[model samples]
Target: MIRTRFAPSPNGLLHLGHAYAAIVAHDLARQHGGEFLLRIEDIDAARSRTELAEAMIEDLRWLGLHWDGPVVWQSTRLGSYGAAADRLRAMGLLYPCRCTRADIAAAATDHGPDGLIYPGTCRGRDVDPAGAAWRLDMARAVEIAGPLVWEDELAGPQHATPEIFGDIVLLRKEAPASYHLAATLDDAADGITLVTRGADLFAASHVHRLLQALLDLPVPRWHHHGLIVEGDGRKLAKRRGSPSLADMRRDGADGRALADALRHALLPAGLSLTTGIGWTT
Candidate 1:
């Protein structure tokens, strides 16, 4: 059975872009006769709001996407992530670096596709464990692991070597679990066989795959769908508030119209979509 997940961080309101991403994941599972599961990526407690989570659930249901299993919350799984980090630490794949934002900005002299590329200034530098930031030692990781390759249904095959994201922060100085660590841990634990989300995360997939290798977990299939662009060509997100489905509801957009717009916006070229296509939201 193909198991897939829609893990959204409840940091803000669900926008049209989020709906598009959700629909793609849910519909793919239904089309494949697989299970669709929901996982709350609320590890960043400071930004994740309970109200937003409730609103997201209501929005997803309103959009007609039903998921199986009780939702998994990332905040509740710190021990698991910590254990995984510990395993990497034991293998000497992790190191303690007390680099702050200022330190990184000052040290990061090169720019890459993902913006300021880490210069690995603290790669082999020694620091006090109590005062240092915890970073994944990518140099050691590459020596232990080789190149990682994964296929995307839409974007085709993707490959990455450790040289891209050198020794990223697994745990921040404040000891909070970063997005890469939490996402990898949850995806592996949930038995997700497929992951469908927006194309913006395409580059980050490499980082996630690296984590999978480091943790010895099964890698899942990836499908990065096209993003929903706003009139200004900027990607729609909660911060932008591109008139959410709830806003549409207030304006009497109804489920059918919302579905129609989403279908027109997301369907691949040459594919025909109609109201009878069984769209839930």
Candidate 2:
């Protein structure tokens, strides 16, 4: 059976981009008669507000997207991520790096879609534990495993060689689990067979695929839908003044309008302003 999830970061309001993702995942699961799951990716507690997290759930439901089972919160699942990191550590795929953001920016030779890839300054450096941050050893990762492949629905096939996102951080300097690690563990644990999210996360799928190989989990099929762009041709973001679903609902806009807007965003070539697609409230 097909199983999927909508893992929102809970860092911002559920905007048009979020609604499109939720609707796509919900529709995909329903079309296949699969289980739809919800996972709160609240690893960044500093930015993940309780109100925003609650709003995410409420907004998703208001969009008529019903999920199965209780929601999974990443903050509470740190131990599992830690254990996975430990497993990678034992396999010699992990090492401690004391490199800061400045250190990486200075060491960058070329940049990819994920920005200045880590320079591996501390690749084989000894870990002081108190001073070192952990980074995945890319050279070792490449030697141990070849390029990670992801079968995408929209973009077709893609791969992320270790050379791209070199030795990514499974654990940070603060030692909290990063999104890449947490997402891989949780998606597999939730048995998510398919993943539908924004095309902006297209590179992220590669990162997640690498994690899947490292963790020995089954990789899920990916469908990276298009983004909701603004008049300036920029993707929608909270910083960009995209209206939140909560704000829209407060202004008497319902899920139908949200769905219509999402559809318009996706298929702009064949746009139609219909609000009666399959929802009422």
Clash number for every model? 4, 0
| RMSD values, in order shown | 5.2, 5.2
What CA RMSD would candidate 1 show?
5.2
Q: List the candidate 1 regions with Cα displacement exceeding 4 Å.
A: 266-281
Prediction 1 TM-score vs. true? 0.88
Off by over 4 Å in 2: 264-281
RMSD in Å for model 2: 5.2
lDDT of 2 by residue, 1-281 (tens): 89988998887898876788788888889899899999998888678898999998988877777999998888888889879988998998888877778888988887866788787777767667675667878678766767678787666677665466767787886637876787788889889999887676667777788778877899899877766665555676786667788998777877776686665554344222222111221
Provide the overall lDDT of each model, using Cα atoms, as 2-decimal numbers.
0.76, 0.77
Error at 64, model 2, angstroms? 1.4
Instruction: Give per-residue CA lDDT, model 1, range 68-164, as digits (tens).
Output: 8898887889899889888988998888876667877888977654667777776777767886668887777876778779777766687766457
